[model samples]
Target: MTAPKAWSYSALSTYVSVCTLKYFFRYVANLEPERSFSRMYFGLAIHAGLEAAYRAWKPDAPAPVGVAKKVFMDDLTIRLEDPMIEFKKGETPEGLLTEGMAVLDVWAKEARYEEIISTESEFTVPLVHPGTGEIFERGLKGWFDLVVKDPDTGEPVVVDFKTTARRFSGDKLEADLQIRVYSYAIRQLYGLDRANLRLDVLVRNKKPVFQRLEVSQDSEGDARLFELVRAAGRGVEAGVFWPNDGSIWCGGCPFTQACARWHDNPDALRSHSEK
Candidate 1:
């Protein structure tokens, strides 16, 4: 007979925190239309599904697995079956699955069996800036999903995988701020030498897209990113959340109703609500 799976408490807490932060970031940063349960659940589903695929590929990697599982189980009890089969069919790999599973395992046991996985691993919460001492008090903390050194230059490349419901038009300038913020944090934590980063967007029903962004140690782009961070900080302090209308993001936004109400009119909000 097979033994029952154990729980990991610390991992579960981190998962809840991360999921909460993601929702907070979108709401506070005005990155999305508004915050709603559907948006949260959808985001969690995509994140979990992709992560499960990664874990199925590399079960030994604790960090990714722990993170992935936490997000999946916390937001949804959905499990990934035949992750290997999903990957072979040209689906995005789930490098974040085990982390997600670890999170769920803890939560389930804690609530049901009263068991938890205890460990000393430091789980960095992405609430404040890891560098520059800037406090995104209202904005959620951000972190890179993956980082690898360039084979030749040994420069670290920060990579983040995003799963969206729609397809990205392969436009770098119009990319999400989360990716750019992540690049900024990576530079600050690892120094300018490791600021090179790339953003990978995996559309659930479309082709995968890649965007390479270089954060030079002394480049104007880096300066801009820092400025944006400062701007975000100020917005957080001022309680400002300017929704981007006509961004093609509102259609899938869960907070559309609230955003429309706040904007004072449906027409005003619709101007930028194209998806």
Candidate 2:
């Protein structure tokens, strides 16, 4: 008898086959291993920097400098064990820190007109569809980078900050599940419709791209997303864990060795890549 998995966007938006086993390894066996990606550390540093910078940003206040990066990396060093991220074996954190700082600087200038409502806001709500009766026993949990109101129209907007290797168009954002989930979740908690959406993509060695994307879904579209949550919950309950043989995501997954052991030879789990 397995316990019901707590529903979350990370578990739902990803492929069920991959996500289910990830859950199995993590919660069931408590054997999920975590890998440290320098890039992930870099991204977190940038996110923390932006969160600090934005929290101090006021429509009439002077834009502060040198504080955001300082605040973020100060704590990050301890978290990542102060490892020198070897981008090319001799690479240092100087360049990466500068780049993330550049993004905050660019945003400080560009976001003068926007009034921020909230940043790093979080929510956990019952998994239910808006304007529909479909509700699940499991709940959804998530965090928002920023929530602001349109200065001119007084409309509420949700803004997400990203540290991307390349630029992304508004079209891709319009189709992303993460943003849709946020939009839907916001409405459910706030009881407001037409909450605008924006994605601030901070690209390395390039000026930050600010994109305002639309997030509107009909009941069917809403139902589609809710179904993903339902399906994840169902799969977890039935212990329907199976290896997704053809998935591209399997390559980067941390559980490959364990996954191989379950289906392949048990002795070969130590060296998953060999076979």
Candidate 3:
């Protein structure tokens, strides 16, 4: 069992919570996915497009509507060249480009940031327990999608963009681990007690819908995040990884073949065992 040098929000949530087996496969064995998901490609393109638009934005000027669409199409075209990208049923590259353009159109019209503070801001900070002042060996690292000054409050707000099949529920918004981690990071970086967080969600529908959701943030969740990261690290050290069978995302996972072969192969586990 071994602990990583750092943990990202995706590591704590997607790898640890989603499936610990995935953590082992990715981190310990360092195995690449058999194929990439089209959704991942689509999201990359969308983010790139949004980043471009936001970069081109000027104070009190019109939104970069055309720039957003063009960049999305260009990025999508480049990503589509990868033959290993697996598209969902009835999802074509052409269809995705069309949908992405439409989504960006909605974003260009609806998304507003009075003052763009930063885009793609990367941060790495020590993971400190709030309750006991315990500092962990593994640090936390992640990138902020966008940061802007709020029109009403004139305070820096962290905004993350998501392209999803449906809008997130209130409970989901409140419970999001990313928010907790981001809140913790904001405090560490800015020395601010409370972090203002927002999610700009793009819903995939016949006609796309854009939603701006504000998440309640405070120092309360920081301790929980610290504990969660600690537990995940402990689990990794103990080599406690098991497939999350019957999960909805299992079918789309790139590790299906490797997961199926795990039980028959003690060598795989031994490869990462503490010497």
Q: List model 1 lDDT by residue over 64-150, tens digit each.
A: 434545456554544333221222233222433433343334332322111111111122333344456564433324344455556
- What's model 3's lDDT at 182? 88
**In candidate 1, how many clashes are counted?**
27
Q: Write the per-residue lDDT of candidate 3 for residues 121-155, one digit (tens) a residue.
A: 99999988888999998989999999888788777
How close is every model to the real structure, measured as TM-score? 0.45, 0.79, 0.95
Candidates ranked, most accurate by lDDT first: 3, 2, 1
Q: Rate the local accuracy (lDDT) of all candidates.
A: 0.40, 0.65, 0.84
Question: If both were scored by lDDT, which would come out higher, candidate 1 or candidate 2?
Answer: 2
Candidate 2 structure quality by residue, lDDT tens digits, 10-85: 6665435355555566555667364445566777887787777777766777555466768666645654574433
- Please give the RMSD to the true structure for each candidate, in Å: 14.4, 5.1, 1.5
For residue 22, give model 3's deviation from the true position in Å.
0.8
Where does candidate 2 stray beyond 4 Å? 1-6, 15-19, 32-34, 82-91, 129-132, 205-220, 245-251, 264-275
Best by TM-score: 3
Which stretches of candidate 3 lie above 4 Å from their native place? none
Worst 10 residues of 1 by lDDT: 112-121
TM-score of 1: 0.45
